[model samples]
Target: MIESISRRKLTVTQQLSASFLLVILIGSLLLSLPLMHNSNAPATTYLDHLFNTVSMVCVTGLSVVPVSQAYNGLGQLTAMLLMQIGGLGLVTLVSLSYYSLKQKMTLSDQSLLQSALSRSNSSGLRPYLFFIYKLTFCLEGVAALILMIDFIPRFGWGHGIFNSLFLAVSAFCNAGFDNFSTTSLTAYATNPIVNITVAFLIIAGGLGFANWLDLVRRFKAYWLEKPRHFKLAFQPLSIHTRLVLYTTATILLLGTVSGWLLELNNPGTLARLNPFQQGMVSFFQSVTMRTAGFATIDYQAANKSTNLLYMLQMIIGGAPGGTAGGIKVTVAALIFLLFKSELKGQKQVVFRNRSIPQALIRQTLTILIFFFLALLSGYFLLLITEPKLDSFSLLFEAISALATVGVSMDVTPNLSTAGRFIIMALMFFGRVGPITVLLSLLNKPEKNIRYAETDLTIA
Candidate 1:
């Protein structure tokens, strides 16, 4: 009986892990269709299809081919649909839609949803799932409508509307694929309407789904409903939300300032732009570094300091349960909390008046270890495959792709086939999650007897 139970558990875990990979495989096959391939270009290679598939499914914006020049409307739409599915998360979306259709959610379904959304098993899962679906679609619609202003005049009514919708979805999903590769939005870099609109959409998307819902619930109850004085009940923000907002703001401000200072004198990059343009580009770069992947300036031409700053931002990506990937803001915050507690000689890790479970702390450390290992392993592979590329640029590209941040230093397209494959695997692992993937592959331990306690000395 025990052996059978263990086997069933292992099987379930394996199936769960395979779900994301299977989706990526299917997406790649569909995108590789002749109609979806660039009409004016050569036949698509397996490597190209795989890389694009992972990038889209992961919602990471790194692409070897210029999106506008490479694929047709059908292809771009396919990519956008993949991004939408990825952004909302496969399991969460399926569960919410299932519930909306008046279907019952099974225990397994609830577990998957909770894991996907990073919610506690004891929390009210159904209502939260519904809120996530409703809030995400509503926000995407608003962002699309706002983006149409700049898109319509340029691309005309039909194409403009379509592009606007696509870009809005892309931005809000934190997928940085743009339709303006030929014209390259370089013309509108200074346009406040375009820049600010994109920035807002990106921020809204980067802020996790839970935070969006929490903000909405509180706003409606406090302001719109106008409850009795001294009876205003505000929903407290979760520790995840607090960490995400605080860390995101800190990274963005620091990244912007550092990018500006580093590139202000670089004649090839930011030197030619006026102060207003320079600042706008700097701010956009800062925002995009956190998994949005859009770039106003050529990342390759960016100085070493700017690239390093971006790598840091990519490593500490958006909040949990959001489309954006990385180690996650909460994980980073927990690490800091753990460190602070250690310094203060506290017994437990606490933040925002909430105590973090010890399991979560261990998980965070494991994630950090896996992340660094994946990054370093990918970098080393790249070094072997493409010896000509500079070490820093290669490392930046590896980390960006691994974090699914999509802020490449422009070495993506130039990578050899082997190098691209390595990145494709990294993107997939990063998106599906390091812990999930690792647990899926490992065997469950059998408990027979307790081991004798022992202590080891360490520095």
Candidate 2:
């Protein structure tokens, strides 16, 4: 057991996972302090606080208690900090601190950062890290300004500015925990200013740092061109960047259009609004449903079809290396292409005239299968633990937990201890990724042994 522990300790992924767990435990203790909650509200339990800490640290918005009622100003700030760290990642944050302090990173530090961001090793890692922070804060600052346009007039200056900043960070992190009472963004469902700003933040954050770096490079080349050369032909994007953009756009379009059509006559959601308002709400929900947890409509009252659609969307999620979490857009796209190629009887799946490696296909399928397995396992556990809860609600909760998209069907708070524990484990696995967690458990291969291949027939 000690040898196994020692071996696992040497893995970068395991270390990172341990770091997050440590952070959550510490944050839970901090949040459980009596000072964190309002004096009039009931005393917050350690379990509830731990759940909130995991949710924030995972950037999953699931909560056993409403943010506004459970937390005072300090607790809210602590939650935001946790989300920021989770979104940026612990390694990125440490790297930035080192950069600020003029300290050189060791090889081990670089490896950890690379693993966390899933970025290829580069000589310019430090510069890229700086760029990430610069871009993140800049986007959040702009978003805060736009949000304040609505918040200020309603809540006044002091409260509005704080709320604006909080919301901006939450949106950018794709962390849906909001301090604005129970309804989330429902109050601003028709408010284009708030909806558009939050939606923009979420999308921008979900595009992933690598895609942003590619865009920046392209922009720089174009900007530096001479007037005569301004008509310069653009270089094509990298395959990864192109795939992420295409899949993201496709999902957003499909979700928005389908949501509009599906919920058009559903009274509690999109039906009561005018055409323009309905369009705005549809677009917002489409954006949020992918990863962000904010809801413009009461999803509990939404149709079963819409709920099912959201489950699929949550599973698909946003781009990798981004604030959003799920199976990842690239994996989803690859799986779709794999199906397309299979149906065409092609031995190789090709995208953009390039044949994808078999290893990648296998990896994608493995991740998807593990996700479903975890979801099924958690759903069954929830059914056993919370027998009174309906299957649909339990399944929805399980999916939400595993996808790290915390849009609950009014069932999260009411869950029993065992159910919460199951959800918490699912949240951790979802954020860290099932493949990652599995990989962390694995030690270096002692030897590579070739085995004869065997095939099994299927229907």
Best by TM-score: 2
User: Can you give the TM-score per candidate against the true fold?
Assistant: 0.88, 0.94
- Compared to the true structure, candidate 2 yields what TM-score? 0.94
lDDT of each: 0.77, 0.85
Q: Mind giving the per-residue lDDT tens digits that candidate 2 earns over 1-459?
A: 112112444677776677678679878999999888877766668999999999998888899988888888898899889999988877678777777899777676776777777775646788888888999999999999988888999999988998999999999998898887776788888988999999999899889999999988978877776763534533456889889988999999999899899999989898888999998988888898778888888888899999899889999989988888889899999999999999999999999999998867877888888888888888888989999988898898898888888888888989999999999999998988753743543324435788999999997
After TM-score superposition, the amount by which residue 376's alpha carbon in candidate 2 deviates from its true location, in angstroms, is 1.1
Candidate 1: C-alpha lDDT: 0.77
TM accuracy, model 1:
0.88
Least accurate stretch of 10 residues (summed lDDT) in model 1? 1-10
Give the clash total for candidate 2. 0
Instruction: List the pairs of residues colliding in candidate 2.
Output: none
Clashing pairs in 1: none
